[model samples]
Target: MRAVSLVPSLSEAVARTAPGVLVGVTDWCTHPAALDAVRVGGTKNPRVELIASLAPDLVIANEEENRAPDLQALRAAGAEVLVTEVRDVPQAFRELARVLDACGVRARPRWLDEAEETWAALPVPDDRLRAVVPIWRRPWMVLGRDTFAGDVLARLGVTPVHADHPDRYPRVPLEELRECGAELVVLPDEPYRFTADDGPEAFPGLPCALVSGRHLTWYGPSLGEAPRVLGRALRAARR
Candidate 1:
């Protein structure tokens, strides 16, 4: 089966589970750095014409990472598109299995199973910290309601300060974020590339944890080590 993936995490999952199935992938699908698929542009603005030209049996995408019009255009061009919605860890696992199954892999991949086991075995955190988790800087957008990254942090005992906001990713003034009374500030290295020299200074007195965006945001093989990796960073920052 020939498949094209627009989402980075899904692309990596398909590439790892069924090696030769991916015929095209978005430019941001960087995992398995040696992936040999036709470059189909960025996720938010994929080259629909180029993708349809590949004549893939199926195209994979995500609700949040991909735009609706692009998916509609692909379907109009006679391409089959499978859209996934993953708001938390359990949903991520379910969607991963579903996507792989759609790609003709009836048996579950071992990495998927290992990922589940790894998350399940994590010991409960002794303390929970309220954090303001930023995904982008310039305008200062943050993780708000029901995001996969927020859920990932929740499992590790780091809750986002804006998790109850109506918008999933809310744009707030930097001044507001600083005075939000959060116990910690978590910065990721993707969608924005926040680093020690950049994001930490914004919240002067609060502890800031610089985490991997792939492990914190992506919902594929990276799930296996997210708990340990994110946990360690959070612990170190608290120290």
Candidate 2:
């Protein structure tokens, strides 16, 4: 079955598990580095005309990563859209299974098994650290309540300071975050491209952990390596 993936992680999942199934993907779907699919467009603003012209049997998207109107337009154009809502690791595994099933893949992908095993074998730190994880910087947005990143951090013994906030991705003031009493500052490298030189300066005295946004936020083959990759970064955090 030919498929078009709007989400990067989903693109990687399909490409890695069933190579020839994907006939189209967004320009942002950079995984499998040598992926040869047609680049439709960006996640938010995909070229619907180009996608419909591909005549794909299925299109995969995420509720958070894709816009509703785009999905509606695909449906309106008689395209079958499989929308996934993956809020945590378990949910990601389940959702991936569903997507693979739809793709006619009967065997479970090895990366999925490895990812689940990796997280399962990890020992949660006994001493939890309160951290403020910022995703974007212009207006200063952060990982708030019910997000997959928050759940990943919690399992690793780092609690999001704004986990109870009303919005999942809330835009809190810089000063408000600095004074939030968090023991550490977790910065991911996407959505805003935070670096050791760029993000750490914002939280003067707190230990700053510069993490890979893909591991911290994405759900796919990267999950297998996320625990180890993120753990090392978190452990090497400096004040």
Candidate 3:
């Protein structure tokens, strides 16, 4: 069946759904690597006319990633639209399942299983591990409570300075870092690769360090080896 997907994560899901049937995908959708077969529409603002002309069986979209109008247009044009929301691992798994269901892909995806075990088995240090996860800087955003980033840190027994609230990535004031009750500042590499040089200089008095954003953050199969990597980092941070 021909399919078009909106985001990278769902693109992976769709590939798992129908191994070689994906015929159209957003520029941002890159997983299964086979999606190279699909014609390109911009990731966010895909050229609807081009995609609709393909006459795909269905289109997949992530609520978090796809712009509303594009999805609505796909639906209006007679494409069956499936919107997925994968904030945490479980949700991600379900979303993958749904996409595979749509694509007639068989069995669960490997990344989901590995990600679950990794989150469950990660060990916490005997003492409280305080940390700050900054996803972006210069109009800084942080990995706060109840997010994939927060879940990852929780696996390591670390607590983010941000409160456990509705906002997963709240743009906080620079001064708030000092008062957040955190000992370590984690700078994620992608989206904004924060380096040692870009360290505590922004907030003068924090124990800040650069971290692998993908390992500690990016959910899905990529999450498999992250715990081990993070464990070593936490231990080294302890040293």
Candidate 4:
């Protein structure tokens, strides 16, 4: 079965679970370090015609990471597309299984099982810290409402300040974010690449936890270690 993955996490999941199945992937699908699939541009602006030319049996994508028009175009070009929606950990696991199954994988991948077990074994936090999670600077877009990253952090005892916002990802002023009464600022290393030197400085006195974006945001194999890695980072930042 020839498959093309537009979402990075799904790409890694498929690559690890069923090697040699993915014929094309987006430029941002960087896991496995040595993935040998054809580059199909970025997720948002994937080369649809180029992808269609590959004549893959199936194309994988996400509701948030990929554009609707692109998926429509793929279908119009006679390509089968499977789109996934993952808002929380449970949904992520379910969707992962669904995508793999669609790719003709009968046996559930060991990593998927490990990730489920790891999350299930995590003890719920007694105290949750309120935080503002910035996915990007400049325009200052933050994690708001229902989001996979926000849910992941919530599991690790960090609650996003804008989780109740009307928009999923809202653009807020830096000053507003600073004054949101959040005790912590959670920054991930992707979509913005927030670092110890770069992002924490903007939050002033608030504790800034620089977490791995892949572990925090991506819902593939990284989910297995997200609890420990994010918990450790949050603990250190609060110290």
Reference-based TM-score, model 4: 0.98
Please write out the lDDT profile of model 1 over residues 79-185, one tens digit for every residue: 99999999999999999999999999989988999999998887787889999999998889999999999999998998899999999999999999999989999
Question: All candidates' lDDT scores?
Answer: 0.94, 0.92, 0.71, 0.94
Residue ranges of candidate 2 with Cα displaced over 4 Å: none
- How well does candidate 2 score on lDDT at residue 106? 96
Write the residue-wise lDDT of candidate 4 on 1-239 in tens digits. Answer: 99999999999999999999999999999998999999999999999999999989999999999999999999999999999999999999999999999999999988999999999988899999999999999999999999999999888888999999999999999999999999999999998999989888988888888999999899898888888898899999999
Output the worst ten-in-a-row residue range by lDDT, candidate 1: 118-127
User: How many clashes (backbone N, Cα, C below 3 Å) per candidate?
Assistant: 0, 0, 0, 0
Candidate 3 lDDT over residue span 1-239, tens digit each: 88877666566655654567778877755566655655557657888888888898888777766789988888888888888776665665566667777787667766667667766665555776678778787788887667766766765777787847468688987778667777887776765878777755775665665667666655545667777787677767656
What lDDT does candidate 4 reach at residue 201? 90
Question: Compared with the true structure, what per-residue lDDT tens digits does model 2 show for residues 43-146?
Answer: 99988999999999999999999999999999998899999999988898899899988988999878788888888887867999999999999889999999
As a whole number from 0 to 100, the lDDT of residue 197 in candidate 3 is 76
Model 2 C-alpha lDDT versus the unseen true structure:
0.92
Any idea what lDDT model 1 has?
A: 0.94
